[model samples]
Target: MSNESPLIQSMRTAVAAAPADVPLRLHLAELLLGEGLGEAAVAEAAVALQHAPGDAGARALMMRAMGLPTPADDKAEKAEKPEEPAAPGPSAGFDWAAAENEVAGAVPPRFVTPARAAGPGVGAPEAPLAADGSGDPGDATAWEVDTPGSVTLADVGGMQEIKERLEAAFLAPMRNPELGRLYGKSLRGGLLMYGPPGCGKTFIARAVAGELGASFMSVSINDVLDMWMGNSERNMHEVFETARRQAPCVLFLDEVDALGAKRSRMQHGGMRNTVNQLLTELDGVGGANEGVFVLAATNVPWDVDIALRRPGRLDRTLLVLPPDAPAREAILRYHLRDRPIESVDLGKLVKVTEDLSGADLAHVCESASERALLDSTRTGVVRMINMKDLLGAAKEVRPSTDPWFASARNVAMFANEGGMYDELLAYLKRKRKL
Candidate 1:
């Protein structure tokens, strides 16, 4: 008998009991490889590959056991191939010239060149403005404005305080034009929404746009950035121009920090110029943006340009925390609507999911459904999602918003200039999380 350790012997016994379990087989193969039993490891890996032919780990182990090079080694070898010229004639009974001409039309080129700006050579200076001041038509299609969204604040589940603040600071003013005009409110200022990721900032922006009965245009960092120099700034300007053309429009800039990162931290001058263009667009120079309502959302408001948050720019800031109890219940119900759920105490679920974001709530529901599915498959009988499954999922899913609050607490304590993070500070204090 072979003198194998008890652990390895037990693993071999367990793998023998579950021969179809590819993962267990792979584990045994790994143990064999670690023990210097290359032949045995290769045998086990070959069996695993028969069970799972596309398993990369099994293939790599097989290669290692057979004394062959690894994938990375093969890649490096191919990269180091010589670039010497080939002989003009065929060799070893291969008709190279005929084969090359036969497939020349069918074989596609290896790479395609990127589109360039309509200007001189790569390093030459180009005109900043077009003859008509509007950018080229090709650039205008970067973002699309939805035609008057149907989602109002009432459709939003919770966050009553956020809704009230929006009404006072933005919506109410826009609704009553006469009163706004009397108070010298230009209706062209900006509001910045800062929060953790996946907390429905974009959805809230759509609701605000719906409340105003205005076109909703969403612009993200990808829409404004380009590989070529000066194109990013022009793209930013074009987005604002599109919004201005469609008056009473809501221009929601998503991930505003990327679009307006701090100039001091930026290494590239093109990024700084993009921020400058954003500032100019927010300023609404020459009364060109009278009815354009600019709303921007960023997870890290502290990283945005100081100029972008000045009084005439994105002046008002709202801190969008995680969903409250009512919001959690609504989110859970929405996610579980299409699933076969039974006896789910949403009230209890909400209590456990405190500080969880909307996305987290959806994940909990998905996890519960998956648990039910696995149970059904094991028993060969269908089963509905239950409270036990839900509780189990909630326990497994750590709150996604915790990390965001941890970072925000420090910023709220020390770097809060002009009480910018006052709402965040108050929340943290109330929760005793500071």
Candidate 2:
């Protein structure tokens, strides 16, 4: 059967006219992925993938379009895309002029892998796919993902208090910047989300920007570091410079500790400076949008530099703890609301999910759905989750926090406050879990 569609033909024309520039090719591939045309997207990625065989960005785009789940095993990617080592000569002896000409004064670009964006619910850029599983230029290239501010506070589960506080700090000012000036402030705040991995910290970061109607720009730790030929450190600076220009913006830095860690702890002399460069940007530089809010997330907050946590810097740390019983119940309800669930005691299930995080809650729900579908064959109809299904599902899963509980508790106590939640200080005094 012919899998080629008309859209694929048009895509080829577009890609034919496409320039070989790295940035433009990336943007075009992203547009294709947004349209759900997988096969074609892979072909576009292959252009760069062929040239820069080791280029993380090119490979990530290709993998995404090809539905290549993960980076083609590191060794496999290298072996597949053979490289020709640079020739040795007078020019090869580390010529500064040659290096300068190669980069042409561009920011030392980092090869950003898409794994960073592969977290649950975060979609990659779009590419077109053919039925026969071939890479083609997409039939169509249109970006239709939920726009900025699409995720409201209501969409978020069980962070009412944090939402309320964040609204006062970020949303309120963003909504009324001029009015904010009347209050003798421009409404600039930095938020650091620390919690167990996969607990929607990154989602919350993106949602916050959308909720605030602020321009959202997400940067990774590796994006801030690259040993490329041009002005690498300056590239880090340019990223923020662009954000500053796009005021009323939210610059989200995920795994922030990777970039903002303490200089003294850094063994690399160059990164010690990179840390400084980042800190300077986080702080105000020439009155750029007091409306700017920097939201950063990290699983391990302890590794972050103390200076970055000072009152004037990335100080406002927000904890997105694992979903509690009520939150998990809510998370289950939120994710399962669209599906059919019969004979399930949500309240009872909530009680049993004492240790579940939001992400864990999602897995549980997915597990229930799969079980119902498989069980439906004999039952003669699609089934919904019940207590037995949920409980059984819960039993099969475990919290990531459990394995590190002992050491985590020790650090939590000595560093954050005697291993007890500050909010639950009074509760723990009467009945301590630690």
Candidate 3:
């Protein structure tokens, strides 16, 4: 007869059945520890550590079995060390800061330190170079601009719906300065473009700038965020200040959700402060952002701070969806323009590439060219890209936007407030995707 108790026998059986299950092994180790079987618990914990070397639980349990201080005890000792530094020998002369640095190497970093600007010492405020190659931090004219963008709405192939919406909501007022002044409409409001990744939101922003005959200044999250306290807020201020100086400029904030995520969901005060700074800049408190037209884009607008969408801020929203048939045809032609093609039927190609984003379409073209190149190499005969290659590539490449829409559908249905996602809901319904 087995000498082990029912609980011990059952746990042994369970561990045998799930030999690779580290958590199950840890549970058994805990039970052994409770029963005062220190040796058995140490063996089990050692095995668990072998499976998950980085697991703090296994390490803590092992330390306990060895009659050593657990991580928690170490932390407690460290906390109370100043008053009673002679409690434990290991911690008596322990370098807590050095230990913390070592642990940080194993964990993912929270932030990266910014490189110091030219002519600044180690602790000086880091400033990025201006577009004019000047290191002057105060020169707002250092803001880079793609002056007189060549891509107008006319260059955008077939997003007629987007064009019309832009005209009525954004472009018309800006174009007719006299009417805008008469109606007391300020040229400082923001427009937020949102959709799946790579649906040409950035391209559309450039087109909008072109339509307004203005310069374009694109800003990403990296351009604004800084590791130093108060530096991130200052960086954001500089971005807006530069835009304001370069009036009639489109200040395009790409991936704005990262820069302005909802404060309620943020765990850190620093992130919340960054969002607040963004709001202040958007409001232009001192009329400092008079002619700078703010335009922001995000794949996940639901993550963006609600305060950013207020009336005078990024109040207006536009959905940049996947390309329609005409747009797809245009994208195909553009990608294949340099490639050798034989009798490519764009109509047939567009029909088959339904729901593909502009980026997906580009990938399809590249894949088709690669396929043709591979075939020519194998057969030792150079041949042009054909419909077969294109269609085959199209069949292999799935629409990247599908996953984005899947997530958006849930947000649109559940968390939508004040008809914020009405356009998204309508699109889903029209496409019978709801």
Which candidate should be chosen as best, given lDDT against the real structure? 3
> Which candidate achieves the best TM-score against the true structure?
1
| CA error at residue 123 for candidate 3, angstroms | 65
Q: C-alpha displacement of 115 in model 1, angstroms?
A: 65
What is the Cα-based lDDT of residue 113 in candidate 1? Answer: 24
How does candidate 2 fare on TM-score? Answer: 0.59
Over 1-434, each residue of candidate 2 has an lDDT whose tens digit, in order, gives 04545555565556568655665666667767777856556656666654554678876776666655555667687888879897767854777867778875554321122245455767533211111101111111111122355555555656666677777755676677678788866578777777666566766666677677766777776566778633546866887777777766777777888878877788977787777777787777776646678888887777888777776567666666566554565576666665666556666777777766666777787787667644643343434566677788888878765543445455666677333245433323443657
Model 1 residue pairs with clashes: none
* CA shift of 380, model 1, Å: 0.5
Q: For model 3, how does the per-residue alpha-carbon lDDT over 1-434 read when each residue is reduced to its tens digit?
A: 16456897799899999988999999998888788777777778777866786799987887787677887998998898777455556745878878899998665432233455645465523221111101111211324666766667877778889999999998998888788789988767699999998678877887788789987888887887889999889988998888877788889898899999999998999888999999999989877787789999999999998999999999999988998887777777677766888767777888999999888888898889778755653443557888899999999999999999999999999999988899999999999989
Candidate 3: which stretches are off by over 4 Å? 1-142
User: Residue-wise lDDT of candidate 1 within 1-434, one digit each (tens)?
Assistant: 18677878999999889998998998888888788877777778777876786799987877786677898888999899976797675467777778889997876422222356665566422212111101111111356877886667776677788989999988888888788899987867689999888788887887788799998888888999999999999999999999998989999898899999999999989899999999988888888888899999999999998988899889999888887776676677667766777667766888998887888888888788778755653443456788899999999999888898899899999999999998999999999997
What TM-score number comes out for model 1? Answer: 0.68
Please tell me which model should have the higher TM-score, number 2 or number 3. Answer: 3
Work out the TM-score per prediction: 0.68, 0.59, 0.67
Show where candidate 1 strays beyond 4 Å: 1-141
Which lDDT values do the candidates have, in the order given? 0.80, 0.63, 0.80
